[model samples]
Target: MTAQDPNRVFKSGFVTIAGAPNAGKSTLLNRIVGQKVSIISSKPQTTRTRILGVCHRPGAQVVFYDTPGIFAAGDRFNAKIVGTALSAVAEADLLLAVVDAARPDPAAEELLAEKIAGRRLPVVIALNKVDLIAEKGALLAMIERWSDRRGCQAVVPVSALDGTQVEELVAALIAALPEGPPYFPEEALTDATERFIAAELIREKIFRLTGEEVPYASAVTVEAFKVSADGRKVSIAATIHLERDSQKGIVIGKGGAMLKRIGSEARREIEQMTGASVFLKLFVRVQKNWRKDAKAIERFGY
Candidate 1:
């Protein structure tokens, strides 16, 4: 976890967060990075890709990868998502293993452990959502449990929601990094483009506003992103892809009210992200059973 030289002036490396669904990995990353590079929701598997965020400090820059949750998969689609979660652990110089202390799932934690077992990377466990646990003894017991886990360099309890012990977690991660110069520029927060973020913001609205299989069966793609000549506003044209024809009416809503709600909420966030007023155009289209087709998943940028 340290460079060969004891007096190295700088340190930089990648830290990938691996854990179960709704473990607060994305929330932790957003808090540490101080921006909304990854969207958050109560739903599992909200993050599908390798979302990269760069944390720039005075002497170090820690790059982070927020991936899909680790879960037991019985189908092709879920297996792909689980693969993305596991792949990130191997590529980083350090790993942050997060778990929900209030709602412990031994099965999911064990699955996460199995994937990272016997790896040489520096591992730090963050028992997240500690604020939800009222009993001090329970927190102590859980802390002891994770401390005994093999291959862990540090065990720090945190609450990503209220900024409790998060700075301590960040300090632990920075201490484990090897000596190197900053990997990204000082002003840079993430590598994601505006178009990709706009699409994700739109998808986040669907996940929060809709229910059942509608969120899982849907994806977003940006067709047009054009800035005006004076650069005061952005005009975006995007489509919400659905796996079944029946889901279209659900997203479109009665008298287009649902779509209007999703669009208005998404546009405001995009405005905050781009610092420009946005004119967003959303459309719904169905490609039958797209999740069942591997080619369709790839085409959707999954």
Candidate 2:
């Protein structure tokens, strides 16, 4: 193959990653962007907001929006999350719908297809988690099934966890994008602020360490973020809000051991991301069913 010209046409556009809860949308976004722009956990609905991650290919710049998982809204909080995901559809030049091949949900898939049907943009379905499928026939069946689905331009089987065939998925998405200039600076990694990423890291630890409804009912807010005069260290103070006093106790654990563990792990991640030492202080508070309260939900930045 001959060397491509520097003046070759460059394609740049936004691609939104949407799927059901625990479908590995965030993982796929991180894999494609080569960075951790969105938090990940085994818990469903881990992502509550839209995160933008930029990828600069050889001849294209693909901006990805990692959206919250789309699901049936059962309450005010869930409705807001689902709304956030659905709203991104209008802003995207193309849609990359991620589906968990290991655990398929036809109802959720149908709903997602319906939302993308009228958008008139190309939709690429990624059959993620193919590594988890023990049988090759099962994987093939899933690829066939998604190929027959409506509104899908192409179906690519991939394993987001181990980066199996992710490059192909990226190529497919880039091919769908129209020729344009870069949407963001070439050096930009994400649109999220440092404080927001710190808060999300804490929440991810909560989701991983806590059990039952504790993680779902909890929210993290970074009240203070300070960098030392020398810029060698960062001081962060955050609060963990829950719906009940009992839930707070569960997060605090015996003699505050659990809270300490969460803080320790979160601080490490924050330091790694910022390349500076961190002093993290955590406090637990009860908001008394904040998920149901519209004002509280808004105040928490949901």
Candidate 3:
């Protein structure tokens, strides 16, 4: 059964994108879905929960769930984050194991292997960031290495950032999906709401712009989202929750410059998404070690 079948049955199922931290799982999801349903950053642990995006094709609707990166979940907080990713794994019909071809983390890879071992799920390994590989032999070796490690449906080398061989990867995933009705409407792109996506966009900007403990300690919550008549404009009130007063100072910057910058950047993306003018207001507050506290984690939607 190949992806190019002329008379293929309509297929749809959940394909959970799973891998270690910074392996380009979210990047691949966004690329395949053709939208930024999940956030991405250079920082590890940027994704904290499951983000679902639907890919509509000729004969199949591929529902993709982007999971948080797998890590050494020893501490309680880390354990909770890892638990979220594991739960998504339990819901997968096909596992798209995306691995970074540029940088390898053996410990995290071992952890991922252990968690999915004996699950009997059909796995497809995507060697993302292949465009970064100057040596074609190295990419082939990695593909061979992954193929020998597991009985994957396919081991595809791709550059999720550059859309290299992504179509092949998509066809492989959709081909693996079981025959069924679409989980979401053909026009639907993601399961997340506007409020959630807006907040995520804000957080993504923070991750991209900030340095040190700022991104790790920060979480955004949309306090109020009001849309005007006919939905041409939206007014949003969101808070950037931090772990310390010092961190809040860092985000606020001199004369509220940093906060303004984050808000401006986030608002532009929100406008593009909503196709409406976004009036965004961001406030920074200290939650004081919220990442370590369970209640705070829940409050932050992690």
TM-score of each: 0.96, 0.96, 0.96
- TM-score of predicted structure 1: 0.96
Per-residue error (Å), model 1, residue 33? 0.4
Candidate 2 displacement at residue 231 in angstroms: 1.4
**What is the clash tally of candidate 1?**
0
Model 1 lDDT per residue over 1-302, tens place? 23334565788999999899889999999999999999898999899888999987756789999989999888888888889888888898999999999898889889888888877777899999999988867878878888787878899999999999998998889888888878888899999999999999999999999999999999999999999998889999999999887799999999999999999999999999989999999999999988889998898887
Q: In candidate 1, where is summed lDDT lowest over 10 consecutive residues?
A: 1-10
Report the Cα RMSD per candidate. 2.6, 1.6, 2.2
Q: Per-prediction count of colliding residue pairs?
A: 0, 0, 0
* Cα lDDT, model 3, residue 36: 87
What overall lDDT, based on C-alpha atoms, would model 1 receive against the true structure?
Answer: 0.91
The digit string of per-residue lDDT tens for model 3 on 21-136 reads: 88999989889889889989999989988999999888788988899888878777778888999888888999999899887667777888888877888899998898888878
Show pairs that collide, candidate 3.
none
